[model samples]
Target: IELAEVVREVTKAENKPFKPMYDWGDRVEDKIFSVANKIYGAEAVDYTATAKKDLARIYELGFDKLPVCIAKTHKSLSDNPHLLGRPKDFLVTVREIIINSGAGFLVPLTGDIIRMPGLPAVPRATVIDIDDDGNIVGLE
Candidate 1:
């Protein structure tokens, strides 16, 4: 669904509109959702019927305070970046689900993706340095 639509639903449920946020390349982690919205043509997509119904039920069960976890690929919006823009007949294979009691939420792992990512072979830290005085410097 469109980002605006998702925000609207959340607002209707929570009684307030959630602020919009976007992250460009600087923060790779935060931009995936925006990319999804762009790829899916905003408002053209929706969560799986089963997932949506489950979320609604959870909300009805006095779980408004609980967290919402979006299960998606850690890769590009197309699930496979090689194929861009709203892909049809694509299948998201969810391997497992985990519940975080402390966090009061459910995690639906949709694919083999890493939450904690490791740097590439040439680490950015290689060029970073901290002096004895605590001053820091890195690639410009």
Candidate 2:
């Protein structure tokens, strides 16, 4: 179904917004450990040498104050994508961390993850065209 069709056919849509549940305190290391170990139920969190250096840089740059946006595979709860379902025992290995101060968040790169490209059956760009008046159309 199209976005509009799905919206129109939706039975119940809650107004409740997301609220962060777990917090291991203000430290960046604590934040990552909190997300990986506490939330994802990881037995432990292993940080790579690059990640260690990144953390040091982040702290030096004072971007460590920002919230963490952990990047991991959608295929599994753990960082390992091939783990499937909810694996009982696993480690969340943070390969590297990058900060976008303008965006105000720290992205901790975990495992081998890729961006989610939402390719639809009918691409929205295919329907987009310029009207007679030179205004864009089919954007909605």
Question: CA lDDT, every prediction?
Answer: 0.49, 0.83
Q: Score residue 42 of candidate 1 by CA lDDT.
A: 34
Per-residue lDDT tens digits of candidate 2, residues 1-140? 69888775663465456567544247888888788876788888889999999999998987877999999988888998788876865889999998878888999989987656659998899999999999999998
Error of 1 at 21 (Å): 18
lDDT of 2: 0.83
Q: Write the per-residue lDDT of candidate 1 for residues 61-129, one digit (tens) a residue.
A: 644343435456544454444546556545443344344557875554444555556479988889899
Give me the candidate number with maximum TM-score.
Answer: 2
* lDDT leader: 2
lDDT of 2 at 110: 92
Q: Quick one: how many clashes does candidate 2 have?
A: 0
List TM-score per model, in order: 0.34, 0.65
